[model samples]
Target: MTSLPESPRPAPTRAAGAFEVRLSDSPLPEPDRRALIASPRFGTVFTDHMARCTWTAGGGWSDRRIEKYGPLNLNPAAAVLHYGQEIFEGLKAYRHADGSVWTFRPEANAARFARSAHRLALPQLSAEDFLGSIEALVRVDAAWVPSGEETSLYLRPFMYASEDFLGVRATQQAEYLVIASPVGPYFAGGVKPVSIWVAQDYHRSGAGGTGAAKCGGNYAASLLPQQEAQSKGCDQVCFLDASTNSLLEELGGMNVFIVGADGSVATPELSGTILEGVTRSSILRLLADSGHDVQERPIALAELRAGLADGSVTEVFACGTAAVITPIGRLAGADFDLAVADGAAGRVTTGLREALTDIQYGRAADPHGWMHRLL
Candidate 1:
């Protein structure tokens, strides 16, 4: 018997103003909205609307709109529920002193989003659409952008398989959505040093795995390890390379760095097992520009421990979109626990955080043109 030809897959394309805005009739009152923005509990409160779009295997992307933020009606057998075909990106919009709103390295996030989509077997979203969705949502909910120090509207853009079949393959239907939340500092009070528990047993990702992808499953795998960290009186968890189990990979949700006593710096090289963090890359650039010797190579656990013991490793820190830069003050494992350089925020860590945030909040000159104005 003759088989029918396969359907032609649509190529990814860019379009301006792809997300049609639909204003919410029941928006939160100004007083209530301001109250929530004054003290947002980091990802708990949402804005008035969300940006959404749909994609099909044969028809490509369609039905783009910004609508009321509400529940989603998904079939019980949705592919994302079973196969875990999902990817997400996190970024923020900063309100400058002059009332202008901007985002840092959004194009980088867009590129990474596309990369993640490919890894998750999802349709690639054009950078233009990725950014347009964010801009549209933020424009409609510009009131949600907070102006306080270390406060901004956090943008979460995610894509998931929406198909209602369980054939154990990539879904034919998918959905992409962008939601905004006004958030305070990722760490509650202020930027302070955080203790970390080294995961001696669990690995975040392995070689030939979805380690490099910014997907939910990777974060899901780290929850237990994170819980263990909290139980051990640490704030976060660190994962080592699965193959060697000695090479420092990264923290649960952030990239890590080791600052040497000689003013040199090093971070684990992109080994396809660590998410390529936008904040991590920006910090590297800032460090390089400031004349510090920056190296990206495998940072072994033994090396870090020895350096810490001998006072060669002056500081350790982690970086991500939410926290920007967090100093790792202590590292504990099954057999050993140690403080990192007086268990305080190091000079390099503080300086890097200030420099990055300065640029982000428009306090310093953006020499690299990394800031993208959204409003």
Candidate 2:
């Protein structure tokens, strides 16, 4: 019953059901959506419509629709709340300079979402259907996309087990939904340097854990360390590899990068433990395109501190969908601390940030064809 045409690729032998778009008659008025867009805050407000698809073992996927946004009447024994079989993704829709709305590298997110679904034992949605769902939502809520500096509409697509029975395993029924929210500037005034606390006591995930997947439980595991960082007046938390306890891994929500004094940039390699962030991958491409030597390898904590102390490391930044790029000014640990480039944002950091945003907003030429126009 899906109105969106299917791709010519062969369907999976055990594919989930496709969804249908049910246009909302009571959609938000233009004036109201515009008013909300004028000063839209991040993740505070939602659009008028949301895309949903349900899955079951016997019937496969069915009852797909873009229904009105509201609370769901869930049973007390829903599997998601009890068993935590859920996964989600975060991406943005940028309103281009010419008033066109587009998303950056959504195919990456779709593929990651499918991987997360498989890891969680949930039904996997096809890449075509995933892209179509995002397109449908963005098209319906195009009015909610703001056109201010550093402003965008953040899209969150999530899937949760919805079976009423809870047996501590993967449920047969699952629900997938996509929601949009117009967001303001991530930084209030300007992009300032952030301090990161080393999470020495707690490890976010192990080697074989679901660390690479963008699942809810991984984030839930970091809340305590995040709070600890907040209490120490730091902005974010950085974790080391659980086994070695020395090599760099990633931050709570973003991937970390360091610029060496040798005019080279280095990021932690995606070793099945770090989240493969879209922004991180984009930065790698942008930096390489700009003729900067980029390396994805294992960097040790001692090396980072030594580089910072000797002025060999020029800049350090974190990248993700939400924060985009945040320069890490200082690294704090139990016994020592080091500041990169006098705790100031470096030239390379700002340049890469601008380049990525340029391609995102369509102000510069997208040589890589990373943007997909939705409206």
Candidate 3:
């Protein structure tokens, strides 16, 4: 990477923070860019520019700039490679019908990113800085935001130790970056009911672990269980609490919810052992606002299975950033298999999915002031 100009260049200013966005000398041709966005795959390609900033004890978060997307020449001894001291967040930019750009609940992602940074012993970047990076990056590559149905520009903002130290302590230097990718629908065939494998041999997070943080290690720990789930003819893995293995914690990558026949919605309460999903929180609020009795409490595995068996729990679904709402049709383990009514997406599940996506894709009113426009 080249050094910032001796004198700062003209920059865009945000209410909270501002940064200079330097255009790339060699940008992708418009034709190729259009063709790629026509049918893009997840995480397979990147935009022309990236937003970045570095932090140090003496210098603070200086040299804020949006530079060309390229490889990093990190030293072999970087602490992150060996010690894994990093945090990251995922959100998306959408193209509305009138050619404006927006994102859903970005402030929540910024808040969670700050919480993850604190948990990882990384520097605390203000919410303004976080939102600035996303807005700035999207503003630079505004064309990459796709306009097709269920298409978006995925934004991944991550920070890691830049210090080339082998010590096991938090490094004094770190680098924050935001990159973008054009992605089509997560499920090309449309949202369908999926089967889940109950993880009998593994736990996603332990007591007092990095469960609530959006760190890489937490996902690394889930890979094995996810692989096992895939091998067991299931679309995902349902993780139980590590201590008791009875109380439901979460799925491998999504928060879970169950709807009963009595117009009640219940999900596993936050116990510091599951991800605080933005989609999960929004769905809960939307359900409660629609006059449903929403409960956040410890949901036991036995309770879920018995409800399914008795036809009381009519619907089950998972939520995350990628696939907003995924219906769970069957729960399979070594000795038991429980299926929801008709093994199809239930009314409550479909209603919640529509309610959330309608707002996300600009089809419904955002009464909660969650959508933040970028362009």
Best by TM-score: 1
Give per-model TM-scores.
0.95, 0.92, 0.94
- CA lDDT, every model vs. true structure: 0.91, 0.85, 0.87
Worst 10 residues of 1 by lDDT: 1-10
Q: Local error of candidate 2 at 238, Å?
A: 0.6
lDDT of 1 by residue, 1-375 (tens): 122342332222234367787888999999999899988889999999999999999999999999999999999999999999999999999888777778999999999999999999999999889988988888789899998878999999999999999999998999999999999989986788899999989999998999999999999999999999999999999999999899999998999999999999999999999999999999999999999999999999989999989999989999999999998889899988888994476889999999999999888999999998777
Candidate 1 ranges with C-alpha deviation above 4 Å: 1-16
Q: How badly does each model clash, as a count of residue pairs?
A: 0, 3, 0
Model 2: lDDT to the true structure: 0.85
Give the winner by lDDT. 1
Model 3: lDDT to the true structure = 0.87
Ranking of models by lDDT: 1, 3, 2
Could you tell me how far off, in angstroms, the CA of residue 184 lies in candidate 2 after the best superposition?
1.8
Question: In candidate 1, how many clashes are counted?
Answer: 0
Number of clashing residue pairs, candidate 3: 0
Show the lowest summed lDDT stretch of 10 residues, model 3: 1-10
Once model 1 is optimally superposed onto the true structure by TM-score, how far is the C-alpha of residue 263 displaced, in angstroms? 0.4
Task: Kindly give the stretch of ten consecutive residues in candidate 2 with the minimal lDDT sum.
Answer: 8-17
Candidate 3: tens digits of C-alpha lDDT, residues 33-102:
9999998877898999999999997899988889999998799998899989999998989776667778
